[model samples]
Target: MSASPLKILLCALEPSADALGADLMAALRKRCPEAAFIGCGGALMAAQGLESLFPVDRFSVIGPVAALQALPAALKAADRLADLAEKEKPQTAILIDSWSFSKIAAMRLRKRAPEMRLIKYVAPQVWASRPRRAQKTAELFDGVLCLFGFETGYFEQAGANTRWVGHPGFQAILAHDSDKAAFRARHNIGAGPLLAVLPGSRAAELKRHAAPFRGAIEKLLTDFPDLRVVVSAAPGAENAVRALAAGWPGGAFVVEGEERFEACRAADAALAASGTATAELALLGTPMVVAYKVELLTELWARAVLTTPHVSLVNIAAGREVAPELLQRDCRPERLAAALAPLMRDGPARRSQIEAFPAIARLLAGERSPGDAAAAAVLDWLGTGKTP
Candidate 1:
């Protein structure tokens, strides 16, 4: 390894992606400690000394309405990021998730500094929907790093240099993320059924999921009066969570910030909005019922192009319905309650999820740790590492 630092540009658009970026940065630093990280990300990556050109939240938004409103700012940030890359001329630029923002920056970087090794850190779900994006990604980046084993064929066939680096978060979760009893004791939660509610992290998610989610909790409370509810809100969505919880009756505890994980660990089962949270719950060995409700327009759009059998990562990874899914109109409060009731009491669905954990773990685990592989791949693409 060289004593001289390598200036590597990295961008992460959301908390999950920021986490992956942080782990990758740590690994890059271990092999090359003086490496300088620059570009956009959240607190986690900022702690790794990332010289962010803008706040990571500037790039976070979901749904057509929110995305439309945020477009101008998002474009300005992407152009600014590309300008930063052109000015600094980093050896490489690794764009993590947030396909919307990353692709724009990638195109801009290619326009100015065509020689920079532009790597797509996490491939988008093109195989599931909008398959044209595979060729689009191939046209933009020099290489692609995939998080799942099954994703390689899509990018490879599209003519992109791709590698399955596994997911660093999965390894981190399995290693240190579960502590059920401690969570219960800290929150004063009893052995009686504890249901976790994870609405979502983004503002749009809060707006869409909060009301219906509250209705579901209320429905459950009527039946299981002793049941304790812990609403685990995403980082930026705490105020929204509190606001929604205020209208609710007794027994629902709202946990946010770092203390939020306590909700996941403390829960008997979870009613979660479909996304990465479902996978996290599965990794925690907690059974969950996943649901999603987008605007009718988006739902229609999703139905038109969606190829995947299930939406939640746990079910997707299981290659079948490990956790029951209720989407669109089916995500009504009554339906949500119906689906979640069994899991709260260790029903068949819960047992099936528990039994499926080992397989999910094996499917996601990398031979080497995720960070080690991600760092090696990035460095190798940059023509630097002395091979581990």
Candidate 2:
């Protein structure tokens, strides 16, 4: 008798998915060495043997305005993914991030082939806000592989098979501690307290966050005169971030592209614009203060739709106010400086935050690894009677 092949189709619809998708493919391949991977991804995924139909970056957008602008392209990409699924007819399909687009694509795939098993790598944040979405998971997704443990209950209650698979970013960070001094030396950074500032990854985010962050840096510099600052510029954001902080006193260093993680791991503390970076900073064991500054129009839209008080994942996971969060009107220079100053200076507070890091890691960690667990779940759904 011949052995059956584990045919899997994975869709990566976000920029962050570029890293996470690649990491997942590598992990899945190790466990099920003969499994085949196809569908949408970026450069990293391509390197890991994922056959992509289109560039994931074109579909990786944030904010309502940007989404509206990119909707036509996103719809077309969804159609392309649907076409690939029909032609390929894999045993199971996995969608990673890019919730809006991925959900649409999954719907299309279901319409075409009702028996195909579909799994979502990251669940929507319905627990914090949009509680109704939790009840609607069964409409689109068959299974959900969650990064946070609390997310499982929502999906399970909604009748979707859910798994709390650990986060790949946390796993990557835990594998090795990047040498702080060596990293500093490589960047020509001198002996001084390092403060890493991550404004954001997109153009609109940079516009809202960069100036306010620079303002806070100016205020903090007055108190901590010996402070050294570095801005981890997101990929495709080098020139815009530099322009935003043009007239600063001490100036700042910019680490563009994939080097942002290295800067975060090396910094003493971070004043990051609220998003996934907060979770990344936590895994890197870097104490950070989260802040957000959005356009008036954007704030108005988010205020009406946002479901939770805290925006940082670290606070969401800890189920309390683990770190100070400054958003909207409260994200002023004086306020940010006050919140971050002590986090940079106080040894005990920093240590306490570091001490709580393992618990957060444990909450996000799952069987084998996120990809392997996901792969196993996918294989089980296939009913092939084979181990992953």
lDDT by candidate, in order shown: 0.81, 0.78
Window of ten residues with lowest summed lDDT in model 2: 379-388
Per-model TM-score, in order, reads 0.76, 0.80
RMSDs, each prediction? 4.6, 4.1
**lDDT tens digits by residue: candidate 2, 126-174:** 8667878766666788778888876788788888778787777667666
**CA lDDT, candidate 1, residue 55:** 76
Model 2 stretches astray by more than 4 angstroms: 1-6, 9-90, 185-191, 257-259, 364-368, 384-388
Top TM-score hit: 2
Model 1: residues >4 Å from true position, as ranges? Answer: 1-26, 32-93, 98-116, 168-172, 201-225, 247-250, 361-369, 381-388
> How good is model 2 by TM-score?
0.80
